[model samples]
Target chain A: MSTLAVAKKEFHDGIRSRVLAGLTVLFGAFMAGAAYYYTEITPPAGIQSSAEPQTIAVINSLIIPTYILLPIIGTILGYKSISGERESGSLKFLLGLPHTRRDVVCGKLLGRSGIITVSVLVGFAVGGLALYALTDAFQIVDFAVLTGVSILLGMVFVSIAIAFSSAVRSSTIATAGAISLVLVFLFFWNVVLTLVGYVAQELSLIETAQSQTPTWLQFFASLNPTGAYQTTSIYLLDNGTRSVPSNPPFYLEEWFGFVILAFWLVVPIGLAYLRFDRTDL
Target chain B: MPAIETIGLTKRYDGVTAVNELDLVVEEGEVFGFLGPNGAGKSTTIDVLLDFTRPTSGTVTVLGEDAQRESQSIRRRTGVLPEGCDLYDRLTGRQHLRFVNESKDADDDPDTMAERVGIPEAIDRKVGGYSKGMKQRLAFGAALVGEPELLILDEPSTGLDPSGAHEMREIVQEESARGATVFFSSHILGQVEAVCDRVGILHDGELVAEDTMEGLRNAMDREAVLTVEVNRVPEDAIAAVRALPGVSGLTTDGTTLSAHCRDGAKAAVINELEAAGASIEDFGLETASLEELFLAYTGDRPSRPIDKPTVAAGIDAAGERTEGHR
Candidate 1:
């Protein structure tokens, strides 16, 4: 009951914040605009020219932007969840009641997860309606799958952001940590991988340096939650239209994307909770 | 069982000890005032009692439960108005009350609480627009929910007007009468003097004095300041008055002389001054203010004319119950 009360308070606080409301509106508008452009302006060549075009074009249009925007929205919503309260001394007022430290941490996670979930749903609803109005082939099942994956992706980033929020005493540090995580995942992970690969080649750690990408490298690349989200969506939404490698290892299979995303969703918050529970506010 | 107990409680931040090795107890159903100036470890001790911070080396129990291990259980029976805490700015006062009610599993009406705290007109307004005193009143109201067995109020009168402070004291007295133990902390003695059953003075991370108000009053009653304005300067009168039995301090400026004396020596001091041939222009007696009593206990040396033989030793002698106090 205490946990629920905390979560309810947090959710209402978010709703009252003008910044969050502005972000949500921007997200919905962007989604609707993207859907309109994909179905009407410049559709994918084969799918658009086909006799019965599918919603595959709209689904494909969502993946790249969702990967970029969802993480940012989630980070903004969660980065100050705990540390800001601590700095402002409201945490004292909160802990003065019967609520425990565990209740606060878990309640913040649940509250922020609800916020990101609603954002994803609202954005999808706006974009889905636009796609339906403009295109003849809606493909409801595939579209639903894509929306579900986007929501999960959003929640994964929220969990990561909240982990940093709970672990640090300063909101500035939490922000820096969360933004650094986003930058590493979005832009620098592959660059760092290539640097490591070059060093490995010079040290004679691989047989061919310039040949096809190794299965191990592919698995390593999939570890980034943003990349894992895209792969997971494709895996779930594919209608026998995509190619697959023959007899890949179990860990390298398309189904493994779900496991990687789940890992990102759970591990950071669990580790942060252990630290938050023990630290003095 | 004691409402609150701490044994050898100490808390160090980095290298500076905020609270030294100390033992304190507040009995059930008593209004125990925790008195100290700023940075005297009063807030630090309260923080440990609520488990907001762990003690460096010691143990604390609140309402018969271990403060560290069973903090939730302690909080379940205790209401705290924590020092330096902020409320949710975007939430209305009524919403804030409802949230507290939900957290404590109580069903208190927001309007009634608003009326109780004297903020009825501001109940529906968001806390972001509240004045400092209004916010304080709301926070105090929050602490009164659930009819708690113990109320831990750290500097509860801060940000209040004189009348608001009086009302808060009245509420403290009411709560005490309702059989709830109130542990109140304040830097000002006036706020706690009327309502507290017993008061403890903390100085430099150590408790300097603890006694009932009646005992403290009796000690203070022993000392009085006698001021006399004479027609001319007389060196012999200064020496004569200083030789009086109960005169411990003497300071003179031009034609005016002030003596810190016990009640018994007031007349004797006047007689000695007249015998030395000084014609008194005017005279008055002044009892020590509560602030002075607080300072004398905390060792700040109350603001007064320069001391001849500082009255500290005399005041210390009067504070006879002070044990292990510097």
Candidate 2:
């Protein structure tokens, strides 16, 4: 109850100080403007269009924001959660209270996660409204699934940021680390995975390559929380249409991707809590 | 019962002992001052008491609860003003107080508490904009918000100006009057002497002396120095002054004679010197103060002497002293 009380106070302060509001505005404007631009060019309803306009539109408008903006928001929300407190000397003040270290970490995570979740929802809402206004009335289920995937993706990055903030002592270092981590997962891991997959293909050992390549790639890919969440999001929003193939033929399935995403959310947080519990701060 | 107790508490960092074999007791409703120079383990002792750092050995009890094993409960009943505390600079002073009060589950009116500590108007301003003294006052308010059973303050007045320091001293007194056991650490002997009912002088990770201000002065057997200006000084008069029951090492400079004597020996030494054919022009006696008492016990050294306690040798010496006392 005390932890939540502290978390609620943080949430109120974050909202009232216009931190959350500013983030919401920025994200909303970006999502809405992008969605509007795409819809204006495409002209989705009643017009003679290419095959699978819905799927292509959704992929182009929805996936870009979810993939790019959600992680950025997640990192921004949590990058300074612990290390900022340390830098300001408020960490010692909080630790001086009767709460356990776990309570402090969890409370901060909950507070920042609330902000991130709200910002993601609002951005998506504005974008969704823009899409619906340009076209006809959109189905609620499609938006719900998309938002759910975005929320999970946000959680994955939030957890990773919390872990980095707890491990590092300086706010600058923690912020840089959290942002770098997200960027690596979002962009670099895919390139590295592609290179590895190519090298395995060229070795002239198809069966051996098939066995070695996908398992290792999936393992490495899971290390990047954002990547894991993106993999899961793609699977959830797949709708039996365009989907990224599992690296290994054996590793295919939406459930396996969900498990990896869930692991990212839980394991990094668990490790952060463990490290925080024993830390002297 | 003691509100706080530590037995054989020790803390070591990288082969250097910060707090060594510390044994302390603080009674309920008593203001206990922990005195030490920098790096003499004052903060380390407070850290161990607050469970911020685990002791290398021994036990610590706060409000009848183990400080380490039941630290949460102990912390619940104790409020701490840690050294070099950095508050949330972005939050207003009122917000900081509200958060701490909420966490403590106390029905604290932040406005009133802030006013009592002389920061009423500034409570709305961002803490980053507060001066050092104002920040220290806010820290004091946070520590007292819950009316905790034990208040642990480490260098609470470090950055405070003279008036702010006076106000902080008053708050400590008020807290003690409210039946809270106040355990504070300070390097200023005058402040401790003014506020604390009992004081412990820690030297090199060990409590070298523990007593009331008067008791410590007495225990040190500090003598008063009497300077006597006379019409003519005699060698025999100086000898007679030194031979007095409580006087020793008398020195004379032509018409002025100076000698160190037990506190109550000044009258007797002067009477004897006067009777021995010296016309005293004027006389003054310097009574033992806390500063002198500290110097006498710590050997008048500007810095703490670095000496590790010998395990077996120290035990034997302590056993002998205990037996002698008994």
True contacts kept of each: 0.87, 0.66
**Best-performing candidate as measured by TM-score:** 1
Give TM-scores of the second chain, every candidate.
0.77, 0.74
- Candidate 1 lDDT, tens digit per residue, A122-209? 8888888887888787778888889888989988998899899999999999999999999999889989789877776778776664
TM-score (2 decimals) of chain A in model 2: 0.82
Most accurate candidate by lDDT: 1
Error of 2 at B283 (Å): 18
* Candidate 1 chain A lDDT trough over 10 residues, lowest sum: A46-55
Model 2, A1-281: lDDT tens digits are 76886687667555554555776788888878877766677644633354344644553466676678778877777778788887776676777888777777788777777777888889888988887786654556666777887787787777778888887777888888888877777778788777776676777534553544555555655656555555666665555656445554444444566777778777887887887666655
Once model 1 is optimally superposed onto the true structure by TM-score, how far is the C-alpha of residue B298 displaced, in angstroms? 2.0
Tell me how each candidate scores on DockQ against the true complex: 0.73, 0.43
Relative to the true interface, what fraction of contacts does candidate 2 keep?
A: 0.66
Point out where model 1 deviates above 4 Å: A49-53, A199-204, A207-210, B223-287, B306-326
Docking class of 2: acceptable
Q: How would you encode candidate 1's per-residue C-alpha lDDT over B1-326 as one tens digit per residue?
A: 89999999999999999999979999999999999998999999999999999999999999999999999999889989988578999899999999899999889899998999999999999999999899999999999998999999999998999999999999999899999999999999988999999999999999988889887787677777766667786778888888888875676767777776787787677668767877666565667666666775565543354333333333333233222221
Clashes by residue pair, model 1: none
